[model samples]
Target: MSKLRVAVIGCGAISKHRHIPEYAANPHVELVAFCDPVQERAKHYAGQYGAKAYTDYETLLREVKPDAVSVCTPNALHAPVSIAAAKAGAHVLVEKPMAATEEEALAMIEAAKENGVYLMVGHNQRLMPHHMKAKQILNAGALGKVLTFRTSFGHPGPESWSVDGRDSWFFRKDEAIMGAMGDLGVHKSDLIRWLLDDEVADVAGFIGTLDKAGTDVDDNAACVLRMKSGIIGTLVASWTYYQGGDNGTVLWCENGIMKIDTHPDDQIIVELRNGSIERHKVGAIATNEKQTASGVIDAFVESIVTKTPPSISGEEGMRSLKVILAAFESQATGQVVRL
Candidate 1:
């Protein structure tokens, strides 16, 4: 079988660590081109993966004509780049937060639909095994009504991802949009929505810039979401976390409470009303993404060939981005924003 020719734009940490490696790993994908404004970085990708390198994205799109492209650039550039790829007749897999704003996100979605190309967002959380298990339990009524739940995702900032290290666009309002909210927060928003199978209706929130090394955007975000399913919950996303653990989501029902993360043995633990706790050993999702490093390339390639929507579609990405936007607006206005 001829492999899916893929062009990767942005030779950043995500491209280097996940996308490139995963494409290289997948038999269905042939990494044909790479683009980064930095000539050296593009050349480095070419050298490593035997791909054509271009500093110009349009040139890569026009000449190489890849079957798919990964938009691994900054949050703000997501829409423009993905739209360009879709217009160029390539399926697009854009990184999360989709875009910095709802308008931009919708533009990307529209471009993909207009261009008749498959558009998938880089929300890999939907593929996590433990989270899926928890969702199954909730759906099976093991978690009962799911009255109150608290989900969080935090890290010690994104210095590892910045070309300028801790001084990159991630801290800038003009480029990165919102700090932790755009980066870490969107992941949780996507996760909770997928888990509960509902959209967020209103959010009462608080965001602070406390305890971070960089600027303007808040490194910490805390918000309460009112789900359309009548489940009210709190979501916390922060770039101020220290040490190693990225302690995450907890769902509480009348019968029990469930906690999930990448812990060694007790990755997913459930506490029963009778005080008995059950522990499940869960490994991370395997692919090309920011964290979990899950198999996004494989899925994207499969979708392109099969004419199927990916696990995370552009519409799903738009939905998650809206939640983040609503949270930000709520924080700014001191009034809950309707979605």
Candidate 2:
């Protein structure tokens, strides 16, 4: 079989850290192209990979004619690039928050469907080893009836990691569309729903630009969510954790409490009513300071090779994106926003 010819659009931090390396490592993939508005960035990756580089994605799509493309651009560019890729008969693996709005998400989905191409979103949290283990335990009824939960993801903001530092598009409202909620909260929203196999019925939250300066987007957000199964929980995402990053989730269940990603060595800790505590060192999750094999690139390639839909389909992406959108709405209206 011919190897899957893959191209990466937007050679930014995500492409540099995750997509490019992972794609290069995949045996079934050939990194054929790299696209970015910055000529130097595109040329650097292309030179390293022995691939073609282009400054515009439209031209890259036309010239390279890749089998798939990873849309690693800013949040606002996700929809257009994805839609154009699908329309050009290429599969799309878009970054989280899928698009700037529900309408754009739907449009991207439609374009992919119309073109008969698979559309996957990069919500790598679900593919984390510990997170997958947590899902299995929950599915097997090990945690019993989950009552409530709390999930948080915070770091020192994108300025520390983004290629542009403090001036990265992450701080721009027009490019990023949102702040930490879109950046980190959306991942938790998707993770919770996948772990519990439930939908968010309603959400209320407060979001603000508390610490970050010269940015219009919120840097901190705390939200209350109620799942369709009556499971209530709290989700927090922030870019103001000056000390260190925290990506943890605690589940309060009827039989026991499950703690995930809360410890440095032991990734999962389960405490039962009978006072038995279990610790499992599954693995470390990907962090801003550390990069791990996310499994998203592999899964995306597997989906194309096997002609199967990705686990994080565009529809699923839209569903997850809705939670963040609702939270934003709730913050603006000061009322619970129904999904």
Candidate 3:
């Protein structure tokens, strides 16, 4: 079988660290092209991979006609790039939050559907081993009825993660739109919804740019969510965790309390009401600084090869983005907003 020709749309930190390397490593993928407004960056990757380089993504799409493309551009460009790739007859794997707004996300979905191409969102948290196991346990009724949950994702900030450091587009309102909420909160929203098999019914929250200086985007966001299953929970995303970072989730259930990534030693811990405890070591979660094979690129390749729907579809990405949008609305109006 011919390997799937893959191209990367951006040469930013995410593209350099995760998407490019993973695609290059995939045995079933042929890294055929690289694109970035910064020609040097794209040329560097293209040269290394022995592929074509272009400053214009449209030109790359037109010339290469890759089987799939990873849209790793800023949040604002996600929709346009993904839509273009889809319309050009290529499957798309767009980064998280999918797009800056719900309308754009929907448009991306529609484009993919119209083009008859797979559109997967890069919500790599779902690909984490610990999260996958948690989903299995919840589905098996091991946790019984999930009563409540709290999930948080925080780090020092995007200053250290982006290619441009503190001056990156992540801090610019026009580019990122929402900060921590869009960047980290959406990941938790998707994970929680996937784990509990429920949708957020309503949301209320506080979002602000409390810590990061000179950035218009919020650095901290704390939200209260009520799931359609009648389960109430708290979701937090912050860029002000000066002490380090905390990316963890805890669920209080009828049978027990389940904790994930809360401890350094154990990746998952479950304490039952009947005096039983379980500890699992499911490997470390991938971080922006520490690059790990997220299984995303491989999964995208397999889905295309087998013509199966991706695990995280475009609709799924839009649903997750809706949670963040509602949280922002709730923050603005000081009232709970329905999904």
- Taking the tens digit of each residue's C-alpha lDDT, what string does model 2 give over 65-150? 99999999999999999999999999999999899999999999999999999999999999999999888877888669999999
Tens digit of per-residue lDDT, candidate 3, span 268-320: 99999999999999889987767778888889899999999998999999999
- Estimate, for each residue in 1-339, the C-alpha lDDT of model 1 and write its tens digit: 688999999988788777888888887888899998889999998988888989999888999988899999877788889999999999999998898777888888899889899999887777767877878878888667888788887767877656668777787788787788888788889999999888898888799899875487888999999999889999989887766536478888889988877455677888889888888877754422235546577788889888887879988998998888888888889999988
> Which of 1 and 3 is the better model by lDDT?
3
Point out where model 2 deviates above 4 Å.
Answer: none
- Indicate the TM-score of model 2: 0.99
lDDT (0-100) at residue 103 of candidate 1?
83
Better of 1 and 3 by TM-score: 3
Q: Estimate every model's Cα lDDT from 0 to 1.
A: 0.84, 0.95, 0.92
Among these predictions, the greatest lDDT belongs to 2
RMSD of each: 2.1, 0.7, 0.9
Clash count in backbone of candidate 3: 0
